[model samples]
Target: MMISETLNCGAIVTTSQKGKGDLIPRAKGAAKLLRIPYVERKRLSLANLQANHKNKDILIFSQKGPQLFTGEGKAHEFHLSMAQLRLIAYDRGETDHLVEALGPEAISSFLDCTAGLGSDSLVVAYAKRSCKKMVALEGNPLLAYITNYGLRHFVHENDTVTAALRRIQVCAVRFETFLQRAKDDSFDVVYFDPMFEVPVTESPQFLSLRGHLVESGFTEAILREAKRVAKERVIVKERPFSSIFQTMEPDELLGGKYSRVAYGVYKVKG
Candidate 1:
């Protein structure tokens, strides 16, 4: 999807009130990269800037990190709490459903088609130590930019987490486009975590993400492309009750019996 289509409310890049000397250049660089305008904060509040810009969304660089403020008053930033918790569990020799779905073989390359906030990708990188090449694709420009920056800079107590973050390469392109251009058997595994058809209403994070998402669905064509690109397997993450299971009819299903989510796997090669 194009930037204009995804961010129809339009967007401008700026620095936070606390951000002055150093953040200014970074904000300007982000604006240039996104092909959007850079507005001088001048100590102006986000609300005041929103009012002046006719309520367009704002991407702000600060001493803390990058944050995206939607025109509708929603704010989003990258956080590693989810991935951290999972990693902690893994350290205790617990099972991770996604990793379990990848099978017992070592993975050399992995492709994440829908890398929302990259929580899953981070876990995979850290757990699948054999995976040397990991690429994550996000269609939304705003999401792509913030996530890419966060993965590279987000500080973590565990050096393993920090190292995992650095291992992923985030690209600002739709998965369909990337998959189409990719050569056959280019990756050891191809994974998709499309936004759930039924929203997890209780989760505040999902609610916030719903507004900014580009909103793509799982389809047979995409599954075919992913299968072609993956040497070993193509996996789809979805709610257990999702209709995609009926339509796609994956070769195997991997997840706990009571788990809310499931991984549908299609083996491509032995």
Candidate 2:
């Protein structure tokens, strides 16, 4: 779903109470880029600000980073989530199923069709340092803006993770649009982690992102596009029971024995 369709009243960018001096200008710049109003936070609470602004969604910039607060009051921010643990496991010589499915060879370029919080892309970037080009696509402008800001600014104690975060190029474009424009065999790997038909209730980040997500279903056409663009393979991360496995019929499946999620790999024909 496009943000405009979900957020009928549109959105505004402002800073938290701690947002002052440089923060204000940065907030204004974000507002300008998003083509939304830049409202002064002043002494008003988020609730008060929403009420005054007719309940438009708020993008709050703080000294820490940018956070998106839905009119419904759910807050979305960038966090490493499972990626941190995955990176730690990688450091300990543990294998990640997604990375393993990406193949053992060094990846030259990778495309993540659904960036979400960018945890997967971050992991790929850290695990596959040989990858020279990494692009992550987020359709919603608000989510894209906050995520792009967070990827660039969020500091991690692990310098490698921080560097990996900096390496990903986040673009606010629909996956279908990006795929359509991309030339055949342009990237080594193209990946999709589409929103599950059934939500994962245990994941707070996923729940928070539920409201902002674009409901672009994974289709055969999209699969074809991904395959055409990928020189090596196109991978779709889905629930084991997802119909994509049957309909799209990946060349191979990879997952842990007890894992709920699985990766379906479609090798591009030469």
Candidate 3:
């Protein structure tokens, strides 16, 4: 698809260019798992799609709101925003702790590899003045549009908290392909916050637009590419009780009422 300018900042991206690096993966058995018709062919955004397409009856939910299902059990509920998570991550000198643990020099040029709604990337941009030249890469086109829209408009105007989002460059591309394009030791820190844990009891406002895309599924390849991209260390966020990262332990513990920030510092002399 071609690019068009929105009222906001840089040109709004909506179309998907079929390429080797494109993230148009057929979500495995999305029909069986998500209980919705899975359109095998990848689409950048369903909003722009022509009316009367396949599975038009089963409308997906919009992802603008804070509601997301975290589990399949009775206790499943919505989680907080990246802003709240960052507050907890920075609380009690943990930002400083993450900086020190990941190495200040290593974090100068950062990349959020699994940039699922571009939330965590915004946090890093706002947390410090030194985090320069940052990119939040999301494979999902609709979420990428949301991320791009919020950065250029809503977030930058209200308060300094969200104002930092504009500083981040939005990349609508697949992670592994980006790694191939990027030079070795290109970024100081590559962060990952994979979609793991239980599905939350989602809200109706959420169910309408976020329908098909929600089942993108967990990606291990993202973690592997994150390790390859970071020159210094890779910091990954995971569920508190049942950790997901199979390799390392968090040298530092950044906690919140619900979630936790677990970081691994891999020293690379670049």
Candidate 4:
């Protein structure tokens, strides 16, 4: 969803603290970036929600980290389930298709053009322990905030996983804008996981993420820029039968027959 749409519906950014004056300044700063009003409350309570913004939807900056409440009692928070899945697959000695397509060991620097909740980005970062740098660009401020918070704070039983999560640098910026300024071969690989053009009932995670998303579907311009910025390869993830894949015509395709997800790859030419 667009930021304007979110603000128009009545939203305020604040801290969950009961009376933390120090948090107010930071909350206000983030509020400015999100273009939402800033309000300070001693405690983030149901009564406070009913009183302050008149029960408007809330974006809270707290000790636990960033979160968005739809006001319908549904809370949107970042989770590292995908990253953890990758670790499990690795333990079983099975390779994720995205890693198979990217040629894992060759990836030292990676760029994720559409970060969303940063699941895919975290997956690759965790898989390639030799990776030196991993940057994920998220266009939506709310998602970026929540994802960044998760990356920094989420703890795993494995220290390596914790280190991998910390290695990612999440930035709130549009993919096209980032690509325009990115130098040639700026990263060893670039990745995109655009929202599907057609709805898939199987995708409950995306369905639950309705209004919380920015609508930047796959586009030729994005792919072109990604190719220019990536040194070795660019990968796009989408449903295999999606029309976008027909036009995308990736140089290499990965994912099993029973798998619903597909990867479209483009290798940079010499």
**What total of clashing residue pairs does each candidate reach?**
0, 2, 17, 2
Worst 10-residue lDDT window for candidate 4 reads 1-10
Q: How far is candidate 1 from the true structure (C-alpha RMSD, Å)?
A: 2.9
TM-score of each: 0.93, 0.92, 0.57, 0.85
lDDT head-to-head 1 vs 4, winner: 1
Candidate 4, 1-270: lDDT as tens digits: 122112333467777756375667878877876777887665657446646667666777666667776554346677775567777987798968988988745578999888887788877877887887899888766767778878888988889888888998888777877889899889999998887765656655555466656678778887888888999999988888878779878788899888778888888874
Q: Which residue segments of model 2 deviate by more than 4 Å?
A: 1-9, 72-74
Candidates 1 and 4, the one with greater TM-score: 1
Residue-level lDDT of model 3, residues 1-270, one tens digit each, is 211122222111212223123222222222233333334324543333323243242222223321222112121112225465555567556644344445544257888766655566766776655777788776644455445555665543336655566677777665666776777778878776655464343434234334334233334555556666777767765555434544444444454455344454444443
Error of 3 at 180 (Å): 2.5
User: lDDT of each structure?
Assistant: 0.84, 0.84, 0.49, 0.76
| Poorly placed runs, candidate 1 (over 4 Å) | 1-9, 71-74
Q: Enumerate residue pairs that collide in model 1.
A: none
Q: How much does each candidate deviate from the true structure in C-alpha RMSD?
A: 2.9, 3.2, 11.1, 4.1
lDDT minimum window of 10 residues, candidate 1: 1-10
Model 1 TM-score (2 dp): 0.93
Model 1 Cα displacement at 6 (Å)? Answer: 10
| lDDT winner, 2 or 3 | 2
